[model samples]
Target: MMIKSLLRISTVKVLILLAGLMLMFAIACGGDDDSAGDSAAAPAAEKKAEPTVVPKKSVHEEAEKKDDSAASGAAATATVAAAKKDEPTATAAPVASSKYGGTLNWGTAPNNNHVFFQQYTPGAGAAWAMNIGDPLMAYGKGSEWLEAKSMAESFEVSPDGQTITFKLKKGVKLHDGTDYNAPLHKWNLDWVLNPDNAAVTRPQISAIDKVTAIDDYTLEVHTDRVYTPLLNALGMMGGMPFSREEYESKGEDHLKTYGSSSNGPFMIEEWIQGEKTVFAANPNYHQKDTYPYLDEIVWVEIADEQVRGAALETGQVDVADINSKSTDVIAALRNADDIFEAKGMAGVRLSHHNAARAPFDDIRVRQAAQMAIDRHAWNDILQGGEGHVYMGSVLPPTSAFAYKVDEYMYEYDPEAAKALLEEYAAEKGLTLPLTHMDAFKCTDEQLEIGCTDLEKREITVTVGKGAANAARAEFEAAAFNAVGFEVTMDIAAGKEGPRTFVTKESSFSLRGFGVRPHPAGSMDSYMGYGGYWNNGSYGTSDAQMELHETLKLAGQAFDYQEQVRLYKKCQQIYLEHALGGVKLANAPSYKFWTTDLRYDGYPDFTEVFFPSDTSLKMYGMYLER
Candidate 1:
């Protein structure tokens, strides 16, 4: 299921570039070690007697002088080495080896609710679900190709690529002692695919035609057509299996309330809603001795970054995913040698504008809003200079479909923004409200910057509450002018939100969408018809129709050249129609962990297998003694 058309640059090049940038940053920050000593010693120097002046030399004499100068240079180098005895010795403490049987205390941001199959479930909740149950396929840690390997066992795909047959690993059992067999697999697939279930991941498997159990150990899945991303989607939330017995016993409403059963390395021990979730190692895990080195894992819900950092420092939490937006927390973590950071540019931020709503319905107003915010300054201040100014596409430069356009539609120019706002005001004679969630640093800052610019142009800008779904509803009902919100990397790619945004076409809101590895996966969600977050229905323009058609073709096309061409065309249409709203900044996903947490036999970071934060293999991680 791998495509070879994308840019093939190695991770080593990225590492080298990062190293070079760090060195340059250090130098620029006046990190020279010898400066203080040199300054102190310079003032003590006294004038020395001048040596006898030398006359102009012949060619032979000049050659001799050059040889003597080289000798003096070697002598000077030796003298400098001898003078370096006063320098302080630097050393790092060695890390201790991994030891088994200790509880790992992890911390993450809390959410209002936690549900396995819902769209609004938090990232931490999703990570917990993965811990409790295995995806049919798993990607290796830091796998650049996004290769999929069978988590349970091997599988074969039909020649036509319409059918996938899985061979289940023997002797596997769920936490409730139910055998993990073909019937169980078929049940889970049917539940997700069933329209009445309203599974948030239903769109991921919309192409699937049927699922049948051939036997107790084998299952066959048939698709309507060749869907390339089916495996990737299955490797996510859609593939998560829940016990059929529990579903029938407790019913759908209470399944999550009773602590779902686990077929993976860990099982839920306790879940204290809004506080924490405790998991215990499942000794009967199918993977045998490969995982669950730790006896227990306690995931503490700590939304405040500073509080989380303090917990890590005070040995309250063994590992925590600190926020990149919290500069102080990141600084503190970097200062502590016991903490390790796993960093990579995994996502980007974008403002989703409602083109159907007035004010934003005017393309000039949308362009003006985009130009009003200073992304560079936002990156420096909010991300602590760890982010890049984002162009108006969800795909990063690494993606194959990422094409360089000749013109930047909206560069940071407050004067231009002011002119646009003035023109809009003169035409409409109405004040607009700029709203954002105060909880998120990026959106909060964007609202402030945008509002300040509009005010400068003699336009009235009002601030509104920052709730995501609530804001969308209010905007859809025409209760507010504009709302600013932050969209997580996954949600941006998945396109999860209220249906009314597409159905009613009443409100225009601004929010960011993160980057995806592939253009088809990212673009199709926003532009394709029947997509979860397709705001294109808000406008019936020819450009919008062309964008939708191009994106649809790009999603279905297997030919690399055709896919790239179609995606590029779609991007052009999107930009031309000003449908993508405002592009903000792209930042690396920064995860910090204590040095004490160790993975027995896993890479530090896995691009697809591991959760968004922490390098410790979800199952293989152990604490050092």
Candidate 2:
């Protein structure tokens, strides 16, 4: 299928249908607003940032068009960009018209997984944890997605590209009053790098060999190799500082529930799981001269899309994240007056095949599974025809190196898939109604609640608590079963998170991967040899090995054109060889905030949220009223 045709959507018709159908529902669901908490921290001493106009066009779309050049330029100039000590990026003075204080009630879905253990949970708790901590670097200003100074005041890369020396800002302290210095930064990186921790983002920073603190405010990072994406990795969650003192004293269990010290703009004030998380402005925030305009930011859990939208419409909540799955609700929000909306590519949903076991171990089986999926139907069913583009090995269509789905993906062809599966079955002498055994484990709580049938003859899949996952599982089961296979989907009845989803014992499973800072990140995380995410589906085939090698070369390449060329080759290799799983579909993320809230220098939500941190310089944000 042509990439243009795949992305073609009747935007006018979709908007019209959604607005006409869901407008009444949204209006009727409006309810009373929650009470705002009192401000404890005194007002910031510094002036607000200067007012800047935010464009209507999605930054994600613009990024897709500009990244090819930006990424190449960064890579080409890596060696020439000498090491230098510089001051932190300054925030210009805020406009006199801007007002300063109000609670920002944000709406989002509830997370049932581990809280405060960000390295483990990619769900709700992780979001809160990110907001609690801060990172070393962040996405640069404007639409370009390059790394810039954040916590680390300045940095200089060694001429060889294997080491990075950082100059940390002085006088910064965590919520518990621990010094936020080079030693603390090294400790944080070590925590993430520890194999026993099993941080979900470990692969992103795995290239780092070690970190050395040259002094209280100076640190050096040594990588195992050239590791081109190191800076980008540091700007993400893995590089966020975590206090070693708290971990040693408070213990992991205690910190997991009640957060530790924070060096970020916000500190955790209260957390009532499944209900809400409230964060107060950090009085000792490093950039105290100007930020965290809001007194408190509350993340209220409203899993229902319609109600979440209604909350925003009725002024109950100042901001809410709209899931594209609920097309009508999002459409209504988009058409709503006096609301500012920022859109970005969230991530892609793909089926992660278990290559460690049969039948996914066979390339033909993997290829057949890929061909069996009805991408268009799945997209419509999951996203309500929101016009999300199909994803490839590399994603978001905005990474420095990305390709059209057709260039490195299989088209939906159930007939061919059925033929291939039949040939495979005949060759392997397999029988109908093949009993697939999924290795099942139970949590202690689940076991206490009477868990049974720890092992079963079905393809076990884990998903959220809703109709969406069930429908998706059904669609997937029907597709594969129709194409010559007796696929019985055993929805894991206990946990509704990734713990069950990532197990290698399942006959097969579906996993959703979020957007990464770089294309090499996407490649290595899912397809690299012995990659952390590539757990069950270890890519060991000759073609898979070649793809991994190509990725390594691309990671080390300094020439912009050479990097692009090598990445393209990596994509071609992924296309020719089914790397662990098949690319399915992707979705767009939308951020909606009421007109009452004003931002002085509001960064893109994609940048803030994607890193799974509160990179928002909230000090610049305030309520007009």
TM-score, per-candidate, Cα-based: 0.68, 0.77
- lDDT of candidates 1 onward, in order: 0.50, 0.57
Best model per TM-score: 2
RMSD in angstroms, all models?
A: 17.9, 16.3
lDDT of 1 by residue, 14-109 (tens): 232212111110000000001100000001111343111112121111111011111111110000111212211222222433455789898876
Clashing pairs in 1: 141-606, 142-606, 142-607, 350-512, 352-511, 435-484, 437-466
lDDT of 2 by residue, 291-358 (tens): 66677888888988899999998988988877657778877876677666655444456666555456
Per lDDT, the best of the predicted structures is: 2
Candidate 1: minimum summed lDDT over ten consecutive residues — where?
A: 25-34
Over 4 Å off, model 1? 1-99, 115-120, 142-152, 357-362, 396-407, 418-511, 514-522, 534-540, 560-572, 600-603, 606-617
